[model samples]
Target: MILFFGTRPGKPETKKLFHSICPYCQQQGALTAFTVKNYFHIFWIKLFKISSHTTIECSHCKRGFYDNEFTEEMKNELSK
Candidate 1:
């Protein structure tokens, strides 16, 4: 019999971290806390969480910012 195992993306969770200006959309109160979690899968079902990350989102223009795009101040803001 053949076995199936691989990686899968879990349902992302988002929280209202705070309101801030979005650089992309240049809009007010467009910033939010976004999270992505990846997991190992077995038979196409997620088994366990393998990795996770947090990011910033702009609701106005519907843009996202990854870890690499975060500045030092941005990092600090998330920590709080």
Candidate 2:
């Protein structure tokens, strides 16, 4: 018998941060928050969610920041 199991990234969810500003671009409302869920799969079928992560990106400058690099204002707006 053979088994196929692995982890895969789920669909990405996006939200615009109205009150957040991009430090690099200095553009308000340009910050968009993206969240994705990682899932464990067995035989090409999703079994369970392993973890989730957040990423902040600037539409104007096309810069991306990880969760750990989030600023205070960015964190506040995302929490709400």
Candidate 3:
């Protein structure tokens, strides 16, 4: 029998935060936050989620940032 167990990244889910500012773009740009998760899979089927990260993107500039870049206040406001 062949055993198949490994970790893989799941599909990213994004939510837009309205009326946001982009420091890089220096404009009133729409901010979108997304979640990416790594999951344990067996036989190509995801068994369980191992780790997850939330990140933000600028709609106008199309830049991405790590979770640490944004404050908890920003996350709390935009994550919902």
lDDT, candidate 3, 1-80, per-residue tens: 99998999999987777656766685564678888899999999999999998888888888877877885556667745
Clashing pairs in 2: none
Count the clashes in each prediction: 0, 0, 0
Residue lDDT tens for model 2, 9-78: 9999999999888989899998899999999999989999999999999999999999889999999998
Could you estimate the TM-score for every candidate? 0.63, 0.83, 0.78
The digit string of per-residue lDDT tens for model 1 on 1-80 reads 98999887788887664545566777766678777899998889888999998889877788888889865645666777
Comparing candidate 1 with candidate 2, which one achieves the higher lDDT?
2
**Candidate 1 deviant stretches above 4 angstroms:** 19-28, 61-63
What TM value does model 1 have? 0.63
